[model samples]
Target: MNDTSEKSSPRPRATILGGGPAGLMAAERLARLADVHVFDSMPSFGRKFLLAGKSGLNITHGEQLEAFLARFGEARTLLEPALRAFPPNAIRDWAEALGIETFEGSSGRIFPVAMKASPLLRAWLARLRESGVSFHARHEWQGWTEDGALRFGTPDGEATFTADVTVLALGGASWPRLGADGSWTPFLSARGVETAPFRPANCGFDIQWSEHLLDRFAGSPLKSISLSFCGRTVKGDFVVTKTGIEGSAVYALSAALRDSLEAGANTVLMLDLAPDRTLSQLASALSAPRGKTSLANHLRKKAGIDGVKAALLREIAGKALLDDPAKLAHAIKNLPLRLDRPRPIAEAISVAGGIALSELDESFMLKKCAGVFAAGEMLDWEAPTGGYLLSACLATGRAAGEGAARWLRRS
Candidate 1:
């Protein structure tokens, strides 16, 4: 094993793999107490984080603690302690300490005032550097050597390093171009670490749209609509893509839809095209006589449905249904469109599965592997967009760091 420990220093050596939000946060936690080293395969740190914040960096949500914790679904029990330890408010406070001001959107999502991740990341890196944390880019972890030392494949060739403690914050399988490709699975598996097969989450599904619909409204937006699947419904907007639909609303219900398809059940996404108008009101409006107003104009004037909405209605329900007022009103209320399959994981916003929680203890340390801990999207948990994903990752990273610190103290 390579002796990376500094004989001149009293602090123990701590090595963190993956320079994402989770890994960086871990380094920050151990910066002053331990000799910290962070490594990433990518040329720079936070590539995926920067991409996500290109539009707006949603730092966390401003919801109640119970509601926020419930967003994690089944993994809530396992993640509760970490989340409660470092909640959303704590994250805001941490950012403020780094000199980044944040504001809450109308939707209760918190974002940095600068509206981009670069400023926050730059400030964070500066703080880490000031605290004496070392960073190394282009160093991809290649599991362990036969002697159990940490092995990494660097640009210069293979290298080995030993540390008193290690933390793995490698992300789940999504956006391979951004460096999180789930390539660490086999390495952990070889050590008897349990993991769940990854699935596409917060993703769009394919739909066999008619060529006419694609030609006219492929890239159009469906605003002020509600999408329902199973027993749940959400109100938001989604874009009609060349292959299928995607956006906030579609991503909200993607988990259920993906599971149904995986179970070999035929999945259909129900759309309420006109959610604000009542069925009776729409029926009464369509009952009016129209001599030569034209079907499109008549529907538009009567039901306030035009553009892509009108195109979708005609495409799904044939012209025969359009002639019937009651049938047309009902169809508008409950339009059923079949979903073929989910988009590829690379195209998804995030992934669903990773290292199973049962493999780790309360301190986020592996039960079988002493002095090694794991955190971030590499864990077996999934949440929708709207800040839930990032929040849990940051929380888990903090927990892992604290856990590793405790281990170092004991040693």
Candidate 2:
């Protein structure tokens, strides 16, 4: 008589289909409990993240939670739970725990002391590797196979991965060169995942600048100026691009401006060329005798408006307005610059629309597709730069990873 032995069961595998901060965080969270793997389309993980930190890695904001949550605008309520679970303070603690100590900047933005992403990423990756989380780069996800297995286009050929749980942090369509091309939208949509069309969020707007102004003023910075639109005012510096305007100030108001343009509304932005000067003060100063001096020279001497600011006044309000002191003062107080359109989503810092919040539960697990979770920019939420974007991504990533782990236990 021959004896037969029973075969051992295979270990539960958890796959993350993106290697951005969101995917990496999720993998880290699940590494100890399951066979965790992260896959990406790029040659390496966190390319966009590294690019963001090229200047300085803004890890999170140091502001209070109420003010921080307001940065998310309409998505605030939807993202509230995850963000509460892992707020900015928690982000700082996490970074410090990874041996990358953080410090708050003048604007309350938190950054690693090294001021770059590489050190932090390297430390985080080492921790993940030690914990047994694996990464597979250049494996572009191509949706699902006929048998419902997760399919990807590898260098050799198409490959499939079946897992007990899946997390899709494929990011939004912004910065496609960094690997978030948004090719997964159609795949999920076909499978009954309700998604919103992606639109540019923190992107620049196109202005019909005269060739003369474009030739001389393009790339010039509007320093310490205040921009007002839709009843909100943001004071910062923005650069005058060849096509239009961009920078921290413009990006702050971009969501409103983009939405207004999309609704076929004429968007006019009011710029205070001389924030320090009042209308009456400017009028009195302009009314003073020029003594045969050029109007540009007079304006510069009296109002401290010259260079790009002077050119912008003449470009939008015309030279005729300068002749009348009252009109000139009024125009200086409120220079109306009409925005024609928003720059393409590809050039945006981040996009607004994606998988709708309705498509996912509080746990960030896709309702239409069980055992599958989504995080980061892939979800339908948008925030401005200055660390709000990365904070939300990490928060949601942790929530999704925990959700996946819970779902795996139940299944």
Candidate 3:
């Protein structure tokens, strides 16, 4: 018994596909008890992560669990375990361990002091390297060889590798330029995995616009506005893009809009240009809007609206409505814009539909592919941005790593 207690640690061997935050986290967790290798198609890893962090990392939110949990929508039940295992607080702590002090904004969205992704990625990658994990960059996964070996098309040429366990952290079909091109679906489907059709999740919708409005207002931002569609209302800024309105606010509501379009009714986004003013109060104030003054001037000066906001009002209710102050005020409060269709998956921030939940075990391992597992956006779940994308990535990566270890241990 004493001799057995002195035995050395058992080192499992694992091969992880993809090298984003999820892949790296898996590699890090596995390296502690296993030999880990991370393969990525991109020239360098974390391109999408870095892109997400370009403005600010928005690592996570500090809101109460109830509110934070609500943001996951239909994904709550599926993501509960992984998220519970490593929640937002855990992410903040992990970042803090890397010397990235995070602070919460008034809205509860958390961000690092430096507010850039590069630094945090640098620290995380350093930790993984220090943990003795190997990284194979520019290595594209091309399904598995007939004999069960992992196949990849590298700069050197096609090559195959095998491991006791394999973790697939391959990202979704968004931002193909960043390398998550969704080319792995067919391969997985061929192996009898019940994969879903990938589509845009947190993306924008196309709104047919008159050429005049498109040309004049395109790219203009309407600040401090609230957009409400269906039962949801998102308060933030939005840009009048040539194709439609887009921004954090619009993208946040894309799933609802996209779903509506699919269900047949054209979805409408009602933009509250002045949510602060009630329609009745606005009507009263506008009942006598600068009598002789032009409507545009009155709208710009009295209502504090001009440019795209004014154009948006006219775009919704029209010039006749604009001339009538009471009508104009009501229109300002409820400027309805029709959404035609969702932007393609290539333009989305994340994707919906993937390896369906029914096809995977609790550990995210594909039931059909015994030694194979999936994590991150590759699985069938989607949440809006604001650090959720990265958080799930880390959480699922860690879960898959733990799962791979367990699988190998059992094998």
In order, candidate lDDTs are: 0.92, 0.90, 0.84
Model 3, residue 127: displacement in angstroms?
1.2
Quality of model 1 by C-alpha lDDT:
0.92
lDDT tens per residue, model 3, 142-257: 99877887888887778787677899988989999998988999999898898888889888888888898998989999899999988889899888888987789988888888
Whose lDDT is higher: candidate 2's or candidate 3's? 2
Candidate 2: misplaced stretches above 4 Å?
1-10
Task: Provide the lowest-lDDT 10-residue window in model 1.
Answer: 1-10
Model 1 misplacement above 4 A: 1-8
Model 3 alpha-carbon drift over 4 Å, by segment: 1-10, 289-291
TM-score for candidate 3: 0.95
Candidate 2's error at 232, in angstroms?
0.9
Shift in Å, residue 29, candidate 1: 0.7
- What is the overall TM-score of model 2 with all chains considered together? 0.95
Q: Write the per-residue lDDT of candidate 1 for residues 1-411, one digit (tens) a residue.
A: 333433456779899999999999999888878989998999999888898889698889999999999999999988999999999999999999999999999999999998999988999999999999999898889999888788888778887877889999999989999999999999999999999999999999999999999999999999999999999999999999999999999999999999999999989999999899999999999989989899899888999899999988998887889999999999888999899999999999899889999999999999989999999999999999988888988999999999999999998
Clashing pairs in 2: none
